[model samples]
Structures are given as structure tokens and as C-alpha cells.
Target chain A: MTIDDGPASDRVRLRRGANNGVYERQAVLDVLDAGLIAHVGVATDDGPIVIPMAYGRSDDSLYLHGSVANAALRAADGTDVCVTVTVIDGLIIGRSPFHNSMQYRSVVVRGRARRLQDDAERVDALRRVSNHVVATWDQARPPTADELRRTMVIAVPLLEMSAKVRTGGPVDEPEDLDGRHWGGSVPITSTFGDAVPSPDLRPGVGVPSSVAALDGTAVHGLTTRP
Target chain B: MTIDDGPASDRVRLRRGANNGVYERQAVLDVLDAGLIAHVGVATDDGPIVIPMAYGRSDDSLYLHGSVANAALRAADGTDVCVTVTVIDGLIIGRSPFHNSMQYRSVVVRGRARRLQDDAERVDALRRVSNHVVATWDQARPPTADELRRTMVIAVPLLEMSAKVRTGGPVDEPEDLDGRHWGGSVPITSTFGDAVPSPDLRPGVGVPSSVAALDGTAVHGLTTRP
Candidate 1:
């Protein structure tokens, strides 16, 4: 299949809790955009292993960079992979510990992840990933030819994916709701603190606009839930 | 293996970047204790998949609670599993886009995960899982007998595990250091927002002490780096 048009279409059907499945592609895209990392899974001879990696999403493709967990992508090497991103919305305290739950928005994308070989494609994918995290790829110094050649990036078609969300508050049994147990939700928030300048930064290099925009604002999906 | 001692001693060998491996058991334990969730990987008939799970660690075993992603644990019944947790500490802006990296600590625990059958073990494991997220299990209403019976829980021995850490700042090319590129790290933080009471909560119910501890202090590994 061509890189632009993948064979992925409707491969994800939740084994259970079917009602929580989100069919809208936009919902999947929203979670992908808000997440900082993707938990990448690949089958190996030994067993299935999951590793966290920084990733960026194109229209219908996910570009996974060869970063800290570079070994995970290199090992996948054009094999079936599942890329999942989870943004926890809040904690639901229920009348019973058994009813305690987390309000979260999660997406699972299943497809064969092919390592991009073309330098041009690799550069584009790398830029997407870099920009997705902090949105300064345009202003930052671009990757050199040698760097591009050395980087190992992979692309996963986003066509076969579904999102599962647990929103609102705890679902407690009627008898326990008004009892002694506290029944409510505690919200969780992730935010970028004030950008700290590098000790060795040039005398007058100001913080880039993209980094400047991260002044205690909320990270989507991970922050502020109703 | 007994519940107290897992067969996991050393199953993790970094496929690459061996220097970053932290072999200390305490290092692995510290990362696990500080983290809020585990990205669990399991092989399915279709392919390998990774799922985000809320997990807890006793002295040697990890207790995984069946929450939103219960399907994954059920599929992994009595199978080898890889549970990984990554806590991002900071974003490193480098002299070149290629050098951009994240400062973080992560642990990968691999073992045969078995679903717990004993009621006593299940109760203990579930309590550990609850307390790990927000240490209020003692105060929260305990699970009912039926709740215990219906809950699906799995235990992964922390015997075979390793911790990979990347701390400190960006490591730019020697020549690129003095160039125009900004080289520093933007620290990322995760904290519990104010406890938001559920709409129908009784007016006399005040925030619990365990949750009150969440007033803006840093989450261990996800916040602040030197």
C-alpha cells in the first residue's frame, strides 16, 4: 500500500465496553494532538513489549521519532504495531473504593508501522513530531543531512483506530451514593511551567514564541475536565 | 514463585544505549512508586498491543486494577507481559532539532502476569493500587464482598526489571554549542488540582487529608529537573 493510502480501515473493535468507543475520527485526532507521548507496542520473539516515544500526527499518519526509546522503533521495522495515547482527565472518587475510576480519554491505533526511508519524508515526519511537542520546528535549527540520514522514524496509518473516553463523575450504586464515602471527581492538570533559559544560550536569544506560549496554561485532555 | 518474591531478577538488557540503564532495584522501585500509571504490553492473537493501566507496587509485585482498560488484562491472562512507566521531567531544546531530547526516568518490568484468584490477595492488591494513585484507601470505603469477587486483577512480579534514566540537560554537538541555537530544557510538571467535590456530595463532607496533600506540590518524576 502507498504511504499516503494505507490498508488500515476499521481494524479496531473494542473487545469489551463497546459503548465507550468513539467512532468520530476528530475525537481520535484531538487526543493524539494533545498527548506528549505514545505508548508503542510491538511483538517480538520473546514477548510483546511496550515503550514510550515522542510522536507527531499527520492527517492520517502518525510519525514516531527515533528518540530516547529509539530501540523500540528500530525493532518494529515495518511490523504490526499498536500506538496508544492516554490523557487522564480526572480521578473519580466513589462511595466505594471499587467504584473509584479515572476520567480519561484514550485512543488506540493499530497498523503496520513502516520505517520511512526517504530523507525528504523523514525530515517532514521529524518536523511534525518536533512541532507537535513544542511547535517550534520552523524557528529551530533544522536537522543536518547527516542527522536526517541517521534518524530512524516510522509512520503508522491512523485509519484503523478508536477512542475510549471515561468522562463525568463516578458511577456509584444508589445505596452508597449518599453515604459516608465522598463521591466526586478530583481533576488532574498538566501544564508547562515558565521556560527556563539554557545557561549557555547566546547573549540575546529570546525564548521562541512556541515555548513562550507554555506559561502555566493547561495541556488538553490532561487538564481541566467538567 | 511466592507472592513475596518474584522470579524477576534481570530480564531487561537495553538493546541500545546501555549506559543509561539503572541496575539498582531501588531505582526501579522508586520510579514505580512515583509513577501514576503503567503502559502494559501483551501479545494478542492479532498482534502485540500496549495499554495504559493503573498499577500498584507492593514489596515485589505490581498490582494492576481492572479499570477502563480491563480488556487488555483479561487478554493477557497468565501470559508474559511488559509493564512500562515513563515520567517526563523536562524538554531539552538543543542546538539542532536532532539534538532535542526529553529528560525522563522510566522502568520496564517484564514477567509472567497471573490473574489473582485468592480473595485475600485480591483485596491487598486492590488496596495497593488505590493507595498508589491517591493515598486515601484507608479512609475510602472498602470494597464490598461482591465487588471483590467481580473485580479482575492481575499481578506482575517485579523480578525481571530495569530502569532507564536520562537526566540533566541537552547534549549538543561540541561545535553547535556556541552557535545561534538555544540549548536548554523546559521542565514539565504534573500536579493534582484542587479537590473538586461531586455535585451531589453532602455539604458537611470536607476534603480528605490524603487528597488535600495534592495542593500544588510537584509529582515526583514528572516535575522539575536540574
Candidate 2:
């Protein structure tokens, strides 16, 4: 297995397939763009806690939001945190039990997450995070002073980020060739469905083109290409 | 918010979103079935390690396998472990930053994992794990004694488990509704594509009907109508 060296800004040198794995930069960004919820792993005084939070990416910086009083945000500030975003493509069914694996794209970012203090920077971070989920959403409505005051946002510079990917058929051992097991691969795909208008919406509210255009296409345009 | 008075097994509780969550048994099982890889969270002497592992479920028991020499397997045995499986459904776009949330289906299982000792039981557990990705695989081939010896499988009884799910549009605070922000939901759905035969397969190898029949359906049939 070939291991690619990480960028200079990387702090925690990923061990490639060992401790830290980064197959390619584009693959990692693709998985990050396609995902909305990230499992933020933070080491606390008690133990490690994996908290699911909404995150947004701007180039290499990843921003996350939580309650102002949340324990995860406090523990993660100025400390090395592991933020993982995984997108499962399919299931690999090998002829033998030992050969089965999952086709997935995952990005592991290890860095010190600093709490955003400046009002303007915090607002910009919130907008970036919002736009990640739905483009042009930040311009739709900006946060009020009070709303921003109640929310806490943290920024983790993707310095030592690495993306690891596994695709294609199961790599079964040669000794198991004649086992006659029904082994193969199952390709998983995710897409967006027709937009369901909210029940409380006023009658005759037309769906926005951005939301309507998602039908029949991958939600985030993130999938393994042949 | 109504705290579900249902039995402990039926109550779906999440510390994050206590309100607007479902605890139905079928719903929980569907989420578990649809997932391919599960992040096994185990508390080790050093700290907490979340390892990705392939899993098989039989009735109320979830099975996990690892190398016999792996420290994860050793720490998981005879200890309380938390196994979390989360499937992202969509991105909720709220008018304000505080209201943003991800539509997801996640199950948090807390219980003790016991190592499988009996050869017969171990063989059966391996078979179930195999059939998890590919149905009808258990009867296709039997594992050799040596193969079973190299693998260590642990079964975690789902005695204390809970499933948390979030769907639909963003729950914006009343004041932010008319705040000029475009608020809606970006729905996500996962489907299985047509099966692709392995490149190394022998010529004229017919595609199994079980694999071929999964087109356009959720891989594990995890969708349930409530």
C-alpha cells in the first residue's frame, strides 16, 4: 500500500493506513462536502466523547457549531480533536467471511480547535456552515445579535487532515478461492428525492429551483466514479 | 415534550434531541440493518478508541469480529461498550444558525459483549456476519476450523439500547420564521444500484438473483412504515 505524504500544515502526521490514512485530498474533500453531520471525537476528563454536530468547510478550515454551554466545545477548544466524516458507498461481499469490507470515503481531521471570539469572524463562520448544507442560504437570513450570542461556534484548521477511501471488490485471500461462497459486491448510492412542502407553508408557495433541482441527482454529488 | 412512557426497550432517548424522536423497535432495527459499517466505541486503558468493524445482527444480538490478537476485541469482551450506527438522511436548513440540524437515524447500544467460545456457535456467528452483506451466503459455504481459529467474534446482547431519529424540515424558533431567510430541507435517500460482477470472476458466471433483486431498494430493507 502506497502512503501519500500530508501537506506542510499537517500537525498530526497521519500514518496513512495505520494511525492516520489519507488516500487523496480530493477524495477527502468530496466526503466532507457530501456530509452534513460529523462525529467530533474529543478527549474529555472523563473519557472520549463522540458528539454529532453540524459542520461546514471553507477550503481547508472546518467549522462546527454547538450550544454555548456544550461540554464538547469546551473540551475541544485549544486541544487536539479528531473530527471524522464517513460516507458509505456500498457493502463488499466477498466469497469468504474474512474478505467482507465496506466501500466508504472517510476524512479524519486532527487539529487544535480554537473558539471563535470575534463577532465578525463568528458570523462569517456561521454563514459558511449554513451555506454548506444549502447554497445561498446564508444570504437568505443572517443571524441577529442575540441569536449569535446564544450559539457557540468552533473552528478547527484542517492542518493534518487526511482522507482514506476503500472502493471496488472485496480482496479475498487466494486460499479461499474454491470455497464456493456467494461472494460479490453491492453498490450503494444516495440521492435526493422530491421536495416535500412543509405542512404549515402558505398555499401556492413554489419550491425554490435550488431545492427542486436536487431530484434525480446525488444530494452532494459525492460518489465513487467508475 | 412527552417523555415516552413506553418500556425501556421501546423508548428512543437521545441526550441531544429529547423531543421529536421515535423509539419504535422496527424503526430501530431498520436503521441498524441499513448500515454496513458500525463504529465500535470501547473504553481502553489508555483512552476511548472508536474502531470501524463489520457487524452482523441476529435477533437482539449484534455480532462483531476482529483479529484474535487485536486489543479492541480484548477490551470489548466482558465490558460495557457503546456501539453507534448513524445514517444521514438529509440536511436541515434553518432560517437561523441555532435551528440547523441534520436529519438522521442513529442507534446507540450500551451493553456487555461476550466472546463466543463454542465452535458451533462461533461458526453460526460467522455465517450470520457473512449473510449480513449478502443474503443466502450462510448456506453457500462452511468455514474451515483454521479459519475460525484465526477470527475472534464477540456478541453484544441488545438489552439496553435506544434509537434516535430526526426527519422533516428545520424547527426554527418562532421569531426567526419571518426573518427573511430561506428555510427548508434537503432530503436524502439511499438506494442500491444494479449489481456489478467482479472483474476477476470466471467467464460466463451468472449473477445471483438475490443480488440482482436488490436494485432500487434499500440494501438491508431498513425502511418501515409506522
Candidate 3:
């Protein structure tokens, strides 16, 4: 696995639109920390499989957890996997349909995933993954002993990874610049809607500060927060 | 490859939360047609790689187009690939952080992707991919012969596919139901913002009717639309 501060290997290298690929460590981490959901891929006897799962980043490793019965975890345990997170920032509408594209920031991490067998490691990884979603683990009830036993957490170190970003407006063809066509981007913002309180909540238990902070926040990216 | 009506192969089968897997053809197609972006995964020499890109659905096959120079297209051509599309509906806030999860609809399609070399087939597939984003290709300039030659379109049949969806609120444990924690869903909505017309647009060329129609449309799942 190629570490930070060097060019990526052929496998993780960007062959097309190389400019969009961000290789610096800080840039790659920014993309990873921003996204809550990651699409993890693993090879199987039949073929490769990809599925969306929640994850948390701790230092140089990304942690993913599920029940012991989860098929993705079972297949990915001690095996190579690819974890990808994509945040669609906007839609690129071009003068010609051929040139139309998406404005997005995506991070791809390729490495071996090892299912954490240590009890303490599993608990900490679960907390990390949970914190990314709610951000108020101290207020919420921590996982019980039995709950930890039923869960499976796997970690993929940030060894071979690259970040690809596309921003700004559409790049129309030279000839089409004068054509009668509208070309620009329609920004897509993902924000938390009105919070619906749980019916079973005890009286006076309003939305927690951690959950309330999500309001109007960008769905992906820690940097977007004020 | 497992056909539409039959049960999915074990490779594509759901084991963790089996009940979330939807095997019916119509249900799976609905999820695929809803999104413009798909995270595609393919095995490589170093490991599996996943990247997000645009896609189009025509009948039983899913089409993905990119430049001939694109690395993903080159690797996926004539090889098995996993195309996963996920639409996040809301964040499930549970009584205990352990039970907290996401409400999302995801479709996973696995099969060998073949690069369309036939000129006519390539042109049609490109149109399908483009139309999914803007929806009105007739008004936009069609790809010229030279543009067609420069693009590579790969088609993955929806033979081995399944849709896994989780909706409604979180189901907390009986003991935690009495806990003092705020819990409910924070709905997530993706809609197009105000259209920013291209600076090069000719006068009187306002936002097209097709683009305007996307003003309040949901990012994924066709059923969410009016």
C-alpha cells in the first residue's frame, strides 16, 4: 500500500481527467471526513459486490460495522476491499447533452479490510462510526456488552487512496458557446429537514444539541460547517 | 446470471437483513431509474476499485458512458463489474446509539460489462445516459459522429440484481424505549436549486422545460416524484 505524500500506484492512479484526482493527504482526508456513508466493494466467487454502509474515520483507518450475520462483513473479513464515498455537489448542465456532467467530490480507498476480533477494538470502532452520524455519543446510551458482541467492525487503513473532485460550471464546446442553449450548474444541497421528535421520548427531551446542529449543514464534508 | 423473475444468486443475496432485499423486477427497476449517479466497482490487479459515474437504464440493461481514455471504462470493459445506486431517505435517530441507522433505498447490479463498439448501439446508449440527467435530449444537440467515436459505453445487464430498502422509524429495544434519549427521523431531501444559466447562453434562451421540471424532484427513487 502506498502511504501518504507520494504518487498513487497504477491501480489507484487516475488515467483520465487526472486533474480532478487529489493526492495530498490533507485533501483526501477532507473528503473522507465529510462523508457519512461509503460504498464498499469486495470480490466474491460469483463476482464483485458493492453496497452502501456507514463508516467512521479514526486517524488513518476507516471503520465499518454491522451485525455478525452481515454478508458483506463475512465476505470482506481479512480480504481486500474498495471503499468509495461520493458527494454530489451539483448537476452540470451543458449546452450540449454530450458534455453534461455532475459536480461531485469522491474519495476512493483501496486496501485489505480486517475484521476486528479484539473486544476493545470493536467497541472503539463502533463508537467512531456512530459518532460520525450523531456526533453526541456521550449523551446517547453506549452499546451494551451484548450489543457489542453481536456487532462486527472492520477497518481499512488509508493506504492506497485518491480524491476526485469536479466543481464550477459546465465547459461547453467552442462552437456551442454561441448556440441557443442554456448551460450552467444546478447546485444540490443536502440538509436536514424539520426534525420529527420520537413519539416514545420522555417529556422535555427536545432535540439534542448534537442532532440539532445538523440543521442546514452540508450532508458531506466537515469543512462546509461554519 | 440470475434472471429477473428468479431468486438472486447467493453472491447478490442479502444475509444481514434479509427482509430488506427486494427481488421483484419492478421494484428493483424503480430504484435503478431514480438516480443519475451510480458507484461502479470492478476488480483490478491490485484490488477492487469503485467510482461514482453517470448511468442510464434501458429495458434490462444499465448503460455507463465515458471517454475512451477513462481508466474505469477501460478496466470495466469486457469484465465483471458491480454497479450500486443508493438513495438516502432519512437519518434514523434511535433511543440508543446502537440502534441508530439510516433509511435508504439501494439497488446492486452485478454482471459483466461489455463496451459497445457498434456505432448505432453506442449512440443510443449515450442518449439514454444523457436523457436520464436532463430528460429532454431532443432539444439538446445530439452527439456528432466524432463525439461518438471518442466515447465508450458499457452495458451491464440487470440479470443479477437486488434492491434493499429500509424505511420508517428505528425499532429500539424494549429496555431502551424508556431511556431518556431524543429519537426520530431527520428527513433528507435532495432538490435542484435555482438554475444558474450559462454566461454564454444566447438571449431569450431561458431554462428549458425539462430542466425546470427537476426543480423539486427527489434525487433518487421514481415513486417519490409526483
Q: Best-fitting candidate, measured by DockQ?
A: 3
lDDT of 1 by residue, A132-202 (tens): 77777877787877777678889999888877788777778888756777877777777777778777677
Name the TM-score of candidate 1.
0.90
Interface RMSD (C-alpha) of each candidate? 2.1, 3.4, 1.6
lDDT, candidate 2, A8-80, per-residue tens: 4433334423433554566567778876567776665544556667788777689998778777688889887
Fnat, model by model in order, equals: 0.70, 0.33, 0.82
Clashing pairs in 3: A34-A221
Best by TM-score: 3
Q: Where does candidate 1 stray beyond 4 Å?
A: A1-11, A67-70, A221-226, B1-11, B67-69, B221-226
lDDT of each: 0.77, 0.68, 0.80
How does candidate 2 fare on TM-score? 0.83
lDDT of 3 at B152: 87
Tens-place lDDT per residue, model 3, B194-222, is 77787767788878788887776666635
Please name the candidate that would achieve the greatest lDDT relative to the true structure.
Answer: 3
lDDT of 3 at A208: 81
